[model samples]
Target: MLNDLPIRKIIHVDMDAFYASVAQLDNPELRGKAIAVGGGGARGVISAASYEARKFGVKSAMSGRLAIKLCPELIFVKTNFDRYNEISKKVRHIFHDYTDLVEPLSLDEAYLDVTANKKGNPSASLLAQEIRNRISTEVGLTASAGISINKFIAKVASDYNKPNGQKTVNPEEVLQFLEDLDIRKFYGVGKVTAEKMYQKGIFTGQDLKGKSLEYLEDHFGKSGSYYYHVVRGIHNSDVKPNRIRKSLAAERTFSENLSSEIFMLEKLDHITEEVVKRLKKSKVSGKTITLKIKYSDFTLQTRSKTLPYFVSEKSIILETAKDLLFQEKMSNSVRLLGISLSNLNTETSKIKVLEAKEKAVSVQLKFEF
Candidate 1:
């Protein structure tokens, strides 16, 4: 199984503070100043903060009031997703110039398989440098990249030197690198998992590798096998492109918690419009409509209904979402509302299955070494 894994050249590209940087670029006077791109209200949460704001411990998902208190001079700018999406498109275009196997994790990050690239480049490191330079020159923003033999290591390496930097891990150095890595820094290990690992005497990759496969599986369940192989540098996940998106959602947190069901119905009307517009843009629709609500106390409730056929019409989605909302009893005053569509069209479903099959077959193919 280890011999079956192919050594593909993968590059992970991540934009540095994308929204905040874009805000700075568009407003020259905001450059070098502590700024956050989010709402400036008592109930508002921050979406992104510039590096300058980091000095004062400002961070994303932080309450606007606390962020302001941390950085007294912090400038708050509203999010401009349309503008950010435009820039993201340009960055993706640059990526396709080198390889077709580009998997975008978000508007700001992607994984690219460049082992057999259109550029005929021999070094993934050089390719990363060129890509970063192009982004800086053309988009007026900086990007960081990491190059390695697989997606897992590459994604982790991308953050080694951020905000316009790159790192390359040669195949020979892969194992030693993993052995020295801290468990807390592992790609998928969240805070809770890391705490559990520390309690188990698993502090680094070497410590994780010391455990037997059966022991790992018994302790961590299905995720046990993942940690076992990753610690040994055996991740074989592909950099897949054109994968069908499972769902499309649009949501908003209100400045004030609303008590009236009538007001929620009105809000759902607008949320449905956003979801429908996004569905049309993606040229896809779903049969499942999910209504998500967050109460003033921060508890969340989701209700979903699946239709016999996919529908992207605004009226259909809005009416269906309204039904889902009213069918469930409100536990408290609502502070957030969202709508999403899933159970996608048949064609997309088939495409996804076929892609998975192809990936599995590719992974099973024997490697040269």
Candidate 2:
């Protein structure tokens, strides 16, 4: 079965310290310094830290207080999504120059299928090098590239050499590489799953591959099938170029927490306006509205309501979000409020329909080996 699958040239490109790097690139003084990009306070969190700051154990999603304790000299810069988005678009344009089959996971990373790219370059490794060089020259930011036969291996290899480097796993070396890889390093195996695998004495890809298909299935359900095949160098998930946007959201944290319902309503209305504006800009509407609240005590709550029809107008979003907000009783003074729209109507709906038809047809074609 593995031999029947066609080989593909996939490349995963990831930016190094994207947010912190951009901050340094735009501000000369921040270059070569320990910096963290995010809010800095008791309620703040680090979004991204430069390599210098990381030396002191500062990392994204860590509390700002903890980050500061680790590196007192760490400079914190507020996030600028608009600026990041602009730079990300420029980076993506470079990818498009090579291949249209680019699947962006985020602003900082993407997977490219260059098996039949416009460049006519048969070497995926060389193409990855060219892409990295172009990004460094044109965008003034560093990126790491990993070239392999599949997306999973490419993504894993991209992280092997951090900051700025590239790794290529040739077709012949794929099995040996997979067999030697640590179970924790396999994509989709989170901390919990890794711990579970550890307890079961399955600490490496070889151990996982040794498990019977029935045993894996009994242990991990559907994911067991994934592990069963992936350990033997099989991952058929394509780099979907037309991945749909699941949701759109806007939120803000207040410097001073608000306890008054009137003040909360006012803030919700403001957030709703921001969300509606983004929806309009995206040219999409949704039937599901969600209201998120963060309290001064650091507790969080969310209320969501799905409507019968799609709506994107500011007034309607505001009214619906307000209703959802009021439905939940405040447990503490609010520090943050957010509004979002989901169940979006777009080309994604058509794609889903097509996929469903394809799946139905394939179900009848399936045969046991």
Residue 181 local lDDT, model 1: 91
Worst 10 residues of 1 by lDDT: 360-369
Index of the highest-TM-score prediction: 1
lDDT tens per residue, model 1, 206-274: 999899999999999999999999888898887777666898999988888999999988899889888
User: RMSD to native for every prediction?
Assistant: 3.5, 5.2
* Model 2 Cα lDDT, one tens digit per residue, 1-369: 656776778899999999999999999999999999995877787899999999999999898889888898989998888899999999999998987778899999999977766676778888999999999999999999988888999998998898899989887788889999999999999999999999999999999989999999999999999999988889988877778999999998887899998998888878888898888888999999998888998898889999999999988899988888779678889999999899999764345335533433343221210
Model 1: per-residue Cα lDDT at residue 36: 92
- Model 2 TM-score (2 dp): 0.89
Off by more than 4 A, model 1? 1-4, 346-369
